[model samples]
Target: MRKFVLAAASSALLLSVSTQPVKADDDLLRLAISLCDFAKTDDRSSMRRKLKAAGMRLRAIYPAIKCGADGSLLRVATVNNAFEAAKFLASKAGDEAINAPEEDGKTLIQWTEGLVAAGDASKQQFVELYKSKM
Candidate 1:
């Protein structure tokens, strides 16, 4: 009976340990999706608050967050016309995030130009911000 109990405990411990990474990944995705929501809603303050609470820097995690189809948080804000969020995200961007190509293989500036040509000229300021970083 003692051996059986030990074996059962060991198996349970191993199973829990093996599932830990998946839980962390899920938490990461959940946080990213919440940030995406804040951007889409133009809620820069809430985004800032959450980032502060999590001790995550936007410049550091910008490329990793996966905000939307565009992948960049700034782009997601821009597409949604969340100007405050777009500007806030843009200002926090490091050069790598600013220059990183979207899924379509175009840099943010190049992508924004297409958006502007298609009549999203309002996002010109974001393009300018990216250019300043470059």
Candidate 2:
């Protein structure tokens, strides 16, 4: 019947639309994390511009930190030694970000401490940032 055909067509259109992945923001977030490791070769200004154009909040939490667990953007930035990205998120999210804990109840400061113990003393700046906020 004509009605049945129309209904099926509409359903297929809706399914396709819904299944399309909106990946701009996700790509930006991943790039932001990667920038931390390649800071010398990366352009922080360009990254920020792209993220802003996509309407992605610098402080938005990405849920990929711990296998579906939620974590602030700051957490990811700090974990990867992305100083600029972490500082930007710290300024935006403030105390909430400074004090955010992982699923294991470990705070950002604690994570930084662990990094320091492991010979990454540069993360000390992050620990100081969170401590100042506290």
**On a 0 to 100 scale, what is the lDDT of residue 82 in model 2?**
67
Steric clash pairs (candidate 2):
none
Looking at candidate 2, the ten consecutive residues that score lowest on lDDT are 1-10
> How many clashing residue pairs, candidate 2?
0
lDDT of 1 by residue, 20-126 (tens): 85664555556677788888889999999988986667776666666545566777887887888877887786777777786789988899888999987888877
Model 2 misses residue 41 by how many Å? 7.6
lDDT agreement with native, every candidate: 0.72, 0.54
Per-model TM values vs. the true structure: 0.75, 0.53
- Cα deviation at 122, candidate 1, in Å, is 2.1
**lDDT, residue 47, model 1:** 92
Please tell me which predicted candidate would have the highest lDDT against the true structure: 1
> Which stretches of candidate 2 lie above 4 Å from their native place?
1-43, 60-72
